[model samples]
Target chain A: MANQPISEPAQKFGERVRARRHELGLSQEQLADKAGLHWTFVGQVERGRRNISLHNLLKLATGLEIDPAELVRGLRRPTG
Target chain B: MANQPISEPAQKFGERVRARRHELGLSQEQLADKAGLHWTFVGQVERGRRNISLHNLLKLATGLEIDPAELVRGLRRPTG
Candidate 1:
């Protein structure tokens, strides 16, 4: 599971996190501290290399000062 | 990490998923099949016993036939 390829949803989620971090003028280290996560993990998440858990997802949203829902606002399920 | 006690967000998320699944008239087995997860895993998720990954979260939303954001629509970051 750790080595699974990144999915489109993961990529988009990473982009949203990166954009939000930029909007807040925070560095990856700063966001990591605020989110109670490691800087390396934050970097991984921003690069879409981690399939983030719900707990960390909420922490990231808190660190970003946004509603948790906002992080996933525009994502849609892929159609078959 | 695997043994962490269930948090409020996880509990709430589970409740939302259960409600939606019931609304859709789907059993845990049915929902699991739709979401491409194991039935036991789906049961754990509905019971808030798993710290679900973002990938599976999206899958669950798709199985529930709702927008991914809808699963998190009213969730807010807890204030410190």
Candidate 2:
């Protein structure tokens, strides 16, 4: 997650990646290979340190076997 | 475009948004209102300076009268 941008949205995105990865029981390295991303990037993304591209986001959705919308679930407005 | 993320991927996404908006004859402010987003965010997104969330993506797709995949058309592997 070194030197990656950590915006509020990006951080939430990373959190979702970790949560989903845990639910799927896949390691970061495994997810990276399937998504065709560098391991470091994947790590950063999971840690909410980097923002991902739409292509990589699609790849992650495909790799996670989840709907594209699922990745954005993190973006929902938090209930007060 | 404030101090937003400016990756190669973000650039293409912005370009796609601009192209689609032109094709639809809509402005960034109009699209923002329809999509229930901030005008600045819309401008930033159209400039590829921000990575959008899935919810916003859905709203954009809906407001633009296009399919979800259409928004992702820019993410396809370039066959150069």
Candidate 3:
């Protein structure tokens, strides 16, 4: 596990969003609407370009029909 | 109850950190050093004045010697 390439936590977070959105068969626009966030903001989040706040994290979790922790799972220390 | 006073999630997050830090007998400066973060950043986070990112969240969790999820538990829907 230590040998795994280090990935930014933001990238992992974005991947989770993409995976969950696909699992729910929801487009970015649909997810954005449900989360009450802008589509561009969703894009930024999904691209790991935004340092999303706790409120937005909760909104996204609610939109994804999951707990907030679920969105943050599997985030291990980044390797060198 | 539904009448519970609405509190921002950031405040709740900060409260958790404060509570946990006290429980662990660690000062903010100590925790900041352990988390490899600035002491001022730790203070800001504890005050709910910072929109902390996932990376920082993990660092805080590590510093607290707790799971990242633990830091976020009990965060309910903000009552309005």
Candidate maximizing DockQ: 1
Q: What is candidate 1's TM-score for chain A?
A: 0.86
Runs in model 1 deviating more than 4 A are A1-5, A76-80, B1-5, B74-80
| TM-score, cand. 1 vs. native | 0.87
List model 2 lDDT by residue over B1-80, tens digit each.
Answer: 45654665566777777888889999888888877778788888887777665556756766676664556643532222
For every candidate, give the share of true A-B contacts it also has.
Answer: 0.62, 0.05, 0.23
**Which tens-of-lDDT digit does each residue in A1-80 have in candidate 3?**
52232357777888889899999999999999998889888887888776677777888887888888887765654444
Give the candidates in order of DockQ, highest first: 1, 3, 2
The better-scoring model by TM-score among 1 and 3 is 1
lDDT of 1: 0.82
What level of docking quality does candidate 3 show? acceptable
Ranking by lDDT: 1, 3, 2
Best by lDDT: 1
Candidate 3 segments exceeding 4 Å error: A1-7, A77-80, B1-7, B74-80
TM-score of each: 0.87, 0.53, 0.80
What's the CA RMSD of model 2 in angstroms?
7.1
Candidate chain B TM-scores, in order:
0.84, 0.80, 0.82
TM-score of chain A of each: 0.86, 0.80, 0.83
- Score residue A44 of candidate 3 by CA lDDT: 75
